[model samples]
Target: MLAPPLAAGELERPLVGQSEAVILSLCTRGNRLPHLMCCISIDEIDSLAPRRDEDSSEGKVAKISVLLSVLEGIKDVPNLMFFSATNRLHMMDEAFLRRMSGKFFVGRPSSEARKRILDKARNALNPKILKKLVVATTNFSGAALR
Candidate 1:
């Protein structure tokens, strides 16, 4: 899971948890079928603001090039299904984002969706209280709901 920091102007490295590394290693080693599946969860992509440096453009470009090379190496291995989830789609790098061409944008739920979701959650609550809680969480995301 790539839990990018929520604060603006915070430059932090992407966090790759242990489980993610193990899965990637398995796929790279040919122990697991590379074409089967790969999953990534990235939260708050919009918060990944680039570092501000007048003379660092070349450095940033070089770093991006290195990352691209690594991605290319992975792509050469057929059968991997890369799944990435991000709330801030607009914050991604154009070049890197392009690789995920057929992207799906899942935004905040509408009032109707909230109603349906409340109906589903109602099973665990008293009917009167469920409606109140759902109404309070008007713009909550699915993750927040969970």
Candidate 2:
């Protein structure tokens, strides 16, 4: 069987306690479907792998070491892929950053998108208030709007 997609915030606990196993599972294939591909998406990557110099706790350091080892072991697995995102790229480990194949920036939501976001609460907010909120929330992220 192919690995299931891991959504944002889903891997936090496992990444602290069982990171190696979690990563290894991404590259495994069920005997009945050996050709199936796997994908793993990790959000807030900086939380899981902060810079070694900034956080030197024994557990944190050990977890990162194990995570890097598992990733290295799976580097040649053609059927496996990873996508990770972080708002604090500067706070992330340099070694972990090196392992990423590419990076992209996603800016704050546009005015139209922000309007739609406020529209979700149309029942709670009067039309006048919603319009004001949309204009007031310029450059806000979707999460911040929520």
TM-score of every candidate relative to the true structure: 0.50, 0.71
In model 1, which range of ten residues has the least summed lDDT?
Answer: 4-13
RMSD of each: 7.0, 3.9
Q: Which residue pairs in model 1 clash with each other?
A: 35-79, 35-80
Model 1: per-residue lDDT, tens digit, 105-144?
A: 6788876677677777656777677767778888897656
For all candidates, what are the clash counts? 2, 0
Best-performing candidate as measured by lDDT: 2
lDDT of 1 at 136: 89
Q: Which residue pairs in model 2 clash with each other?
A: none
Model 2 lDDT per residue over 1-146, tens place: 34554543454453455654554454443222448655666777777788997549765676566557555543345555667888899989889778777889999998889989878856588878888998999998898898
Q: How accurate locally is residue 116 in candidate 2, as Cα lDDT from 0 to 100?
A: 93
lDDT of 2: 0.69
Task: Judging by TM-score against the true structure, name the best candidate.
Answer: 2
TM-score of 1: 0.50
Reference-based lDDT, residue 35, model 1: 46
